[model samples]
Target: MPAPVLLPPTSYDYVTVHKVQGTTITAASDILAAEEPLEIRLGFGPTGQREHRTLAITMRTPGHDFELAAGFLLTEGIISRRQELHGILYCPDVEKVEERENVVRAELASTVPVALPRLERHFYTSSSCGVCGKTSIEAVQAAACPVLPTDGPYVAAELLHQLPERLRAQQELFEQTGGLHAAALFSPEGELLLLREDVGRHNALDKVIGAALLQEWLPLHQHVLLVSGRVSFELVQKAAVAGIAVLAAVGAPSSLAVQAAHNFGLTVCGFLRQGRYNVYSHPWRIVGAATAGL
Candidate 1:
């Protein structure tokens, strides 16, 4: 057995004394979120043959760390299914633990090398939005994913407005400091299923996806994924990998995110507040809502 890797302490700052309305007032703040460097390490073999490699570094909350790594591998197109993972463990080196305890390595059971180049379209925290440069519309078309095949049930407008509050209520870490992002899964009836919070928005999404994969509930094309922040291309790609058809966010969706959703035949909605939301991609699935007939 290897030694457990201990991550550094994390806290979010939410209290601030600021002048408001010409008076200094103590207020709840959101800037003091926990930020920690988490390193994902790759591990292989059972004992003496074990090998390790530093995969990617990400800033995120410390909880559910294993799920985050698994999700990252999936979205990167390195491993599509949960069964591919041989084992995930903390590094055994004592010196390595002190210097890089946050580091985690994954070992694939198969001998086939996972190609990172195929993941050029995948976005990690360290990669810029458009680092791949411009591609001809046709070239972009070639990389597009097809629409999800599933029968979607109708969701109501009031249910859409209630999701943010539901997700907020479950964010244990965020409630303490108000500095983390959350990703949640909801049934067609707007019931909350699972929610994960992380310092990095992408990490949160990955955790939720990883959880879904472990439960064999993947290809979530029938359910909905809700985020507490704006939608990004990276988020869209993760959703696409899980076959999630509907992605709703509390903020805005980037141009590339919207394009990615449309390319994948997903329904992208943003600015979900006060019973109103803007649908960016396919809207036909949201039946019975005021915007459904439109």
Candidate 2:
């Protein structure tokens, strides 16, 4: 196994001034940079077998790299849970550091092929745009998974309205650079369970899901997920795979996300700010909210 190459952090230079003895004096500056890369690699092989097959590569910030890999595999329907991942390691055969590039290969327990569509919509070098590789809206419809419901949980208006702030407060990267997106999970009681942040919104969700998988908490059927960005079809898809019943977004959801939620019987809420939000699907879960006024 090859050692993980961690990238450095991003930083910015700043200066401060002081006024003493009726005179102004100024200090200096600093340098800042963050760890970021595109990890690329292939799928599973025999236990002692090591044949490299081209899987997928994604450009991302470097912390929790393993989680990123596992999450990518799970969300793509490649593997269902953390147990499916036998091992994840860099290709040690390559000699030169440059050869490593942004590649990371994951080995699964089985020799099965991932069942996702052949379309390349999910692969991307960046997250500025959400799920940019699909062929058509109808294609998404075809892959639209069935929703499973257990019990309907009601969320209070005050708690539903305050999720954005709680999610925002947990985003350390956003607080510093103001450039990242975040995703969080909360119990039905509105207790914050876990949170993740990334340069991309989808990646943020993946990291959170990946963490949950590592913890053996899949099919988040009883949990509520919140996103710092808008809700998209892909985000809804990810939520569905995690079995999350409710998805709240700080921004508005696209038409496709709404449709996906409707088809899957998910609870989708957007524009979650200023004590207001719009429910796109399964509105019954969000009880006692002043939704009519919105």
Candidate 3:
């Protein structure tokens, strides 16, 4: 059978809608954040013996498909170092010229190994939640991901409150459709390193991490990850895999997310809006957190 052809993502769609104010109704055009399936495939094996196999299909806002594929692979423990990856490319079959660029084939270094059985087990992830219906922390930890480092780069309470606003300002897609998730990576000095938006919060984050990985920025021990919405276990797990020190969310976090953060030594903060936020774990990273708790 022929391999599946992945197509490029459509970031948004234009459609007509009705607007009602008081008692009057009017028709108008509106924009929507585009959502589409992105199939991630891994290409591995000896030179002429290399082959392509589907890894996972996720719904994400179109654009940055390659970064998303790379990030997903990294967080999934499939590939770690940028050196381990050769390149993520679009299929170049002259016969399939009309194919959408959504399908990405990640070619790993010939020296890098491929674990087919383990890779297949994680192909069922969705855009909504990385750990949907997942039983325990162990289920998420099956990736053999490393623990996050707990050192310097302690952020200030003032900065933590400012992250949501910083992330919000960079949300270009959300500004247009008011319907997209954003994930941003920030330096300890509160500098925005990368920002990515997606229909799924998890996918948005994957793009951010993928971008960093593509640039050989793994083991982000001095970095902070800010998401536009609530944090989930999957998000924390992904951060841990990348060695992020801090994970902050604009909204609340799930119990599992808190536990994951606590377990992995990641500082998880949530409800990060209106100049107030809660530190779920590793409160020491936030300046004066102990004083705040008192």
Instruction: State candidate 1's TM-score.
Output: 0.79
Model 2 spans with C-alpha error above 4 angstroms? 1-35, 47-50, 93-102, 114-146, 290-294
Where does candidate 3 clash, by residue pair?
6-103, 7-100, 7-101, 7-102, 7-103, 8-100, 8-101, 8-102, 11-34, 12-34
lDDT of each: 0.71, 0.69, 0.80
Superior by lDDT: candidate 1 or candidate 2 = 1
Error (Å) of candidate 2 at residue 108 is 0.5
Off by over 4 Å in 1: 1-31, 44-51, 94-100, 116-147, 291-294
lDDT of model 3 at position 172: 66
In Å, residue 141's CA in model 1 sits off its true spot by 8.6
Best by TM-score: 3
Please identify which of the two predictions, 1 or 2, would achieve the higher TM-score against the true structure.
Answer: 1
